[model samples]
Target: MAGRGEKTVRAVRRPEVRLPQLAAYDGGELEAEGDYDGLEFADADWAGQSARGARFMDCAVRRCALDETVLGRARFIDSVLSGVRGVGTDLSQASLRDVEVSDARLGGTQLHGAVLERVVVRGGKIDFPNLRQAKLRDVAFEGCVLVEADFAGAVLERVTFDDCTLTRVDFSEARMTDVDLRGAAALDIARGIDRLSGAVISPAQLLDLAPVFAAQIGVRVE
Candidate 1:
C-alpha cells in the first residue's frame, strides 16, 4: 500500500477503441432488453425512456439526450458516447467495458452498483454521479469535472484521474488498489479521509487535504 503522499508507480492501462463501420439506428423508443450492435445513435432523444437490461456493443452514441432515461443492468462493450447530455439518467448496475465517454454533460446520473473496466471518460462535466458500490478497474478520467460525486462503498483498482477536478466527492467505505489521484487538478473529499491506504496522491494534494487528515486523527494544527 502506498502512503498518502506517495505516488503510485503502477501505470494504468488505457483503452484503445477501434470502431468499424456503424449502421444508423432508426428506433423510436428504447425497448427493454434491446440489443444494439455496431449502431450509431446520433442526435437521438432518449428522454424518459427505459432500456432495462439492454446490451450495446461496438456502438457509438453521439449528441444524444438521455434525460430521465433508465438503463438498469445494461451492458456496454467497446462503445463510445460522445457529447451526450443528460439529467437524472439512471444507469444503475450497468456494465461498461472498453468504453469511451467524452465531452458529456450529465447531472444527477445514477450509476450505483455499476461495473466499469477499461473505460475512459474524457473532457466532460458530471454532477451528482452516484457510483456507490460500483467496481471500477483500469478506468481513466481525463480533463473532466465532477461535482458532488458519490463514490461511497465503491471498489477502484488501477484507476487514474488525469487533470480531473473532483469537488465534494464522498469515498466512504470505498476500497482502492493502485488508485492514482496524483494527476487530479483538484480533489475535495467530503468523507472517508482515512480510507486512502491503498490509494496515492501527490504531495500538493496531501498538503491540501492535511486539514481533513488532521481532523480525522483528532490533531489540531496551529
Candidate 2:
C-alpha cells in the first residue's frame, strides 16, 4: 500500500509558472547583494522564484505567498513567517532555526534534506508535504492539520505535535527519538501502531490503546 501511494504521488506533477519575473530586492527595497542577511520581507509576493544560498536573519515575512518557489541551501534564522502560502515550494537543503510559522499553508512542499531546529508551526495546513532526509530537533507543531505528509528517512528529536490532526501521514523509515505525543488526539494518529516505533505518549493515550490490548489478550469488556 505504501509503495502504491508513493507511485501515485510521483505520477502527479505540479503546474509551472507563467507570470512575468518579479524584481528581487533586499532590505529597504535595496538591490540584493551576495550573502544577504538580516532582511525583512513582509507582505511580498515572491512566487515562482528560487532563493538559493541566501541567509535571511531576523526577518519578518508576513502575508507573503511563495508559491512554487525553490529555496535551496537557504538559512532562515530567527524569522517570523505568518499567513504565508508556500504551495508546491521546494525547500531542499534549507535550514530554519528559531523560526515561527503560523497560519500558513504548505501544500505539496518538498523539505528534503532540510534542518528545522527550535521551530514552531501553528494553525496551518501542510498537505502532501515531504520531509525526507530532513533533520528536525526541538520542533513543535501546534494546532496544525497535516494530510498525507511524508517523513521518510528523516531524523526527529524532541519533536512535539500538540493538538494537530494528522491524516494519512507517513513516518516510515524515520528515526525518532525523545518524541512526545502527549495531549495529542488519538484519532489524529494515522497508520498502525507498529509504524510508530519510537514515539512516546501519555497515559491518556494508553486508554486509546486499551482496546487493542484487550483484543490481543482475549478479554471481554462491556
Candidate 3:
C-alpha cells in the first residue's frame, strides 16, 4: 500500500511524434516500431478507431483525447497517458502493465474483461466507467473521483483506493479480496458498498458505514 502522496515522476516535456493513422486497420497488430524513447502526443484526437491488438510501448500521450475508440485486446506497457480524456471508449480485454493514467477524464468508458497490473490512476475523474469482470491486481487509485462507476463482477485482489471519491459507485457481486478503502470518501453514495463482504475502511468512514451495518445486523449505532 502506497501513501496518499506517493507519485512517480517522469519527464514532462519530450519530443513530439504523431501517431500513425489507421484509417482501415482492424484486427491487425499495430506494434510500436523502434524505441519510442522521447516521443509525445499533444492535443491529438484518436476517435472512432478499431484498435484491436495494438501495442503502445514506452510511449507518452499527453493532453490527447481518445473518445469513442475501440481499444479491445490492446496492450499498453510502460506508457504514460496524462491529461487524456476518453468517453464511451471500449478497453475490454486490454492489458495495461506499469501504466500511469493520471489527471484524465474517462467518463463512460468500458474496461470490462481487462487485466490491470501495477496500474496507477491518480487525480482523475473516471465517472460512469465500467470495470465488470476485470482482473485487477496491485492496482492503486489515489485522489480519484469515481462517480457512478461500475465494478460489478470484477476480481479485485490487493486493490487500494486512497483518498478517492467513490460516490454512487457500484461494487455489487464483485470479488474484492483485501480491498482497502481506508482514506476514501463515499458517504453520500448509494449501493457502493452493498456487496463488500471483506473490505476495510478507516475509523472516520466507519461512522458513515454504521447505518448500513445497523440495517444489516438489526442494531442501532447510537
For model 2, how does the per-residue alpha-carbon lDDT over 1-222 read when each residue is reduced to its tens digit?
122223211111111212232233453422222355455566777787767767777666778888987777788777777888978987888999888889998789888899998888889788888888899888888899888777888887777778987776667678876666664554344434444555666656768766754664678789
Candidate 3 lDDT, tens digit per residue, 88-182? 88888898887888899888888999998878888979888889889988788889999887788888877777778888777778886667777
Cα lDDT of model 3 overall? 0.72
Ordered from best to worst lDDT, the candidate numbers read 1, 3, 2
Each model's TM-score, in the order given?
A: 0.96, 0.75, 0.77
**Whole-model Cα lDDT per candidate?**
0.93, 0.70, 0.72
Of the candidates shown, which would achieve the greatest TM-score relative to the real structure?
1
**TM-score for candidate 1, residues paired by index:** 0.96
Greater-TM-score candidate between 1 and 3: 1
Candidate 3 clash figure, as a count: 0
Candidate 3 clashing pairs?
A: none
For model 2, the stretches where C-alpha displacement exceeds 4 angstroms are 1-34, 186-192, 203-222
Model 3 misplaced stretches (Cα beyond 4 Å): 1-39, 187-189, 192-194, 217-222
Deviation (Å) of 8 in candidate 3: 24
Whole-model lDDT, model 1: 0.93
